[model samples]
Target: MAGVGTVRSIISDSLGRSVMAEQPPKIVILTAPGEGLPDGLEALSGEAELLVAENGAQLRAALPGAQVLCVTDFRTNAISEAWSAADSLQWIHATSAGVDALLTAEVRESSIPVTNARGIFDRCIAEYVLGQIIAFCKDFAENQRLQQRHEWHHRETEPVTGRTVLVVGAGSIGRQIAQICGAMGMAVDGIGRGARPGDNDFGAIYAQADLISVLSDYDFVVIAAPLTPDTEGLFGAAEFQAMASSARLINIGRGPIVRTADLVSALQDGEIDGAALDVFEQEPLPAQHPLWDLPNVAISAHMAGDFIGWKRALSEQFITNYRRWAAGDALNNLVDKTHGFVPSTTNR
Candidate 1:
């Protein structure tokens, strides 16, 4: 098949030993026009036949013989509708950490393995979380609000050095977040799908089911868990009510995990003091959404994990995996598709 060819290459250098030629594999780079493959990715030229697909028509046309699908435009769902044409697809790589959008019914029915850009965003996102924590503790939002009025209103700010933080995810990003928080002298506890003792940077680990009992213990409620059946709408009225009224919420995970309406009401009713939401249940949050009007809320356009050259990093990660795939080795950052996140390394 055109997309399933074996890679063939010659080895010549220091030792100068000759080997049989290897054929290149076929790879389809599925992305929007401007979001094409990153620079330096062309280095694969000698080892693979690369196809670029910019639309449903283009993707469907390329799928028949393409062995690897690289979803560079993570927002598109053309792959699901075009799956039937991907007769030779052996693996899929999503540039985004979240693969839920790419794993459609057709994809779920197929056996092709899926990989993602996982580690690339961990440090950046953890740093973003720390910034949010500091901003909230320092009352930066209120300071800005007061400044807009040209009035000097001085106030005392709470110190975060010994405050408690509850990170509701134990994946790589969560661990990084814990380490930073712990280093700054904050008490950090992590909650995971299957929680256990003695996890790094965490004072303790709590199971998902224990969120209610644990909600009141932390000054910051940080959601960094993946979107899954068990975690969807994980924080609702009951959970919010259990939290201390002075506690602030930070969500860097999928938006649906915190019920929007419930969160709004919680904030409105002073169930929680404030919130810093990076991701929302809806993208490009509607113009009239109540969250925007709230005084204590700080919102971002979902760029917490985005750092300069992130696209290139994603490309490099995929290329590293490509080498593994071509050599028949186990892939890295293998998402637990059945669970919607990477299982802890210990679990793996």
Candidate 2:
């Protein structure tokens, strides 16, 4: 439990000034037991009252004096109640990058500072994307299916060596994907909210306006951007139509980025070669959804970045940030409630 103790100590040290003012706050975990608390935080169970409340009532009961609330895949109703019941709440940290699920009307309306595990999964997810691309290009899935049927079929395997990849986000995750693709000898282009000059990692970086114009140029398009107002439905019919006939798309960012119906149409029409989607516009992807039957589409249960050590990594990140907070240093990856990320003014 030394890890937990260390986390508590770091948090205490970070809040030393506030604690000295007779305002020490409790930390609450408002996620299901199945979701698992971040490692190192369990040590705080003794030093600090650790409450794992999965429902609104339990959350409300535990929120009276809580300062920091860590939430995973639990519902937003509990989050709303916790925020409403705890007037002393100072910060909230989501275990996932996309906070949209936790953005209940009440929580969003509150002034509490919220942060997410933004950069932690960048490398892991980029690797997953790369692996999927390689698997699809090498026809691994097709080969396995053919083998299972006891049929030996020889087919030409495509190489991703000279393919062009259009990364639709220049953030940490997108940048990581671009770097990996570049290392594989693939030409990489990036699109983000702003266009920065001389971003060597990418062959070119363009603003949102240029997405359509350049969509047809890339052999593969990967979406790793945040789910924001501007990015909702960013890839629709027109965007898919603009892609090359042999192009494929991969979305590891947020669901709803590509309209599912339009994507189905594109796949059915052979407008694009294939797609690999880890996230869906709807969770659990509904059992009867037609997407499940698409031969060219691979559907994952939104689990690209979930590695075995995710909890430990999340704990380490929290600990580092807690130490910085204790030292009165500026926090890393602070979320700008208004514009999401404060729009990295200096374009990359």
Candidate 1 stretches greater than 4 Å from native: 1-23
Query: For model 2, how does the per-residue alpha-carbon lDDT over 123-224 read when each residue is reduced to its tens digit?
Result: 889999999899889988798789999998988998989989999988778888999989999999899887777986888889988899999998899999
- What is the TM-score of each predicted model, taking all chains together? 0.90, 0.87
Query: Per-prediction count of colliding residue pairs?
Result: 6, 1
RMSD of 1: 5.5
Question: What is the lDDT for 80 in model 2?
Answer: 61
- How many pairs in model 1 have backbone atoms within 3 A of each other, for residues 3 or more apart or on separate chains, i.e. clashes? 6
lDDT tens per residue, model 1, 264-340: 99999999999999999898899999999999999999888999998778878888989888877788888777887
Please report the candidate that would top TM-score against the real structure: 1
Candidate 1: residue 283 lDDT (0-100): 86
Q: Which 10 residues in a row give candidate 1 its minimum summed lDDT?
A: 1-10
